[model samples]
Target: MTISWLYIGIFLVVSLGLPAVAIILAGILAPKKPSPEKSIIYECGVDTHGETWVQFKAQYYLIGLVFLIFDIETVFLYPWAVAFDRLGLFAVLEGLLFIGILTGGLVYAWKKGAFEWA
Candidate 1:
């Protein structure tokens, strides 16, 4: 048990130390050149126009989050589906329950006008 703990302690030290060392070395060795153009916000090789801090509609984020949630649901379900033949009836019922919960959430969001483009 102590040997196993020793291994874990070493692994933890290396994992945490490597990134810290890399970050410190990068800060020490990287170029320190500073200029007005570099300080200015640059993106897509185009000069920024108008207000960059414009507020977006909350509906856009809702749509994106809904899409992401469903996308992740597919990721989790795909493996379960691939192994469906070996799974028992209880597994099937549990999977259906998970899907039902997500579906109910979708219906709630729909009723709350989260899907509205306006």
Candidate 2:
């Protein structure tokens, strides 16, 4: 019992102490330079031309959410398709229902002008 506790104590000490040690060592050994160019925001090596926060239409977020919902629906369908033989008709019906709900959501989003892209 005490041996198990010793292992746990060692584990706790190592996990907690390792991060502090790394930070202390880095603080001591790391470079102490702050150049103006080094502090600039990076964007794939291309120079930033304008303001960072631009006005975006709410439709963009709605379309993104719709894509995410459909993407998740596809992910669920793939696993269900793999085990489809074992699950038989019940799984098929469930999968169909999931697709139906996602399709309905897509149609609703279309009606709400989410796909306008303007």
Candidate 3:
């Protein structure tokens, strides 16, 4: 058991260390040149003008949150669907309950006008 934990610790260390080392190496090897063109804010291949910080509508964030919630629902559902045949009745009930909660959330969002295109 202790050896298993040691192996897990080493695995975690290496996993985390690899990304840190790569970022550090890239920083060291990369050029340090800076110019006016590089400093200017560019968007969609077009040069930006006027205020850089524009206030976005709350509706956009609400719609995005709803989309993200459903997207994660599919991630959770896929494994359950794959192992549907081997699962017992209780597992099926739990999955139904999970789906029910998400449905309730969707209905709530609909009532709150989160789906409105305006």
Candidate 4:
């Protein structure tokens, strides 16, 4: 009974009190000043130019998403391959199915013009 309460107390102290103390100390010690030069956006110690938001083609995101999907799906094949000897035909069939699905996705993306550089 007392042991559980002790653990609860410890958890509360570590999670809540420690963070509160650190934040309060930092706020008290930190400088609070703003100037025109410091207010501007700084990138690589150079003045930033133009609007931060820029228009992008949907094809760029489509290609990136397709690459990610295929890349992650392909990694699963490695573990399946390693266990192929033990799993026999089952692993082979499963891997083929997985590859077939991703290949279909690849075909769809290709047909949709995801692979085009322009």
User: Among these predicted structures, which one has the highest lDDT?
Assistant: 3
What local lDDT does model 2 show for residue 112? 84
Q: Determine the backbone clash count of candidate 3.
A: 0
Per-residue error (Å), model 4, residue 48? 6.7
Candidate 1 TM-score to native: 0.53
| Candidate 2 lDDT, 1-118, residue by residue in tens | 9999999999999999999999999999999898999988888788889887989888768877888988977987887888877896877897899889988988898888888877
Residue 61's C-alpha lDDT in candidate 3? 93
User: Regarding lDDT, does 3 or 4 come out ahead?
Assistant: 3
TM-score of each: 0.53, 0.52, 0.53, 0.53
Better of 1 and 2 by lDDT: 1
Q: How close is candidate 2 to the true structure, as a TM-score?
A: 0.52
The model with the greater lDDT, 1 or 4, is 1
Off by over 4 Å in 1: 1-49
Give the per-residue lDDT of model 4 (tens digit) for 22-107.
99999999997989888887776887778778798887788789879988998988998788889868768878998999899989
Q: Positional deviation of 35 in candidate 4, in angstroms?
A: 14
Misplaced by over 4 Å in model 2 are 1-50
The candidate with the higher TM-score, 3 or 4, is 3
lDDT to native, each model: 0.92, 0.87, 0.93, 0.87
Worst window of 10 by summed lDDT in candidate 2: 56-65
Deviation in Å, model 4, residue 69 alpha carbon? 1.2
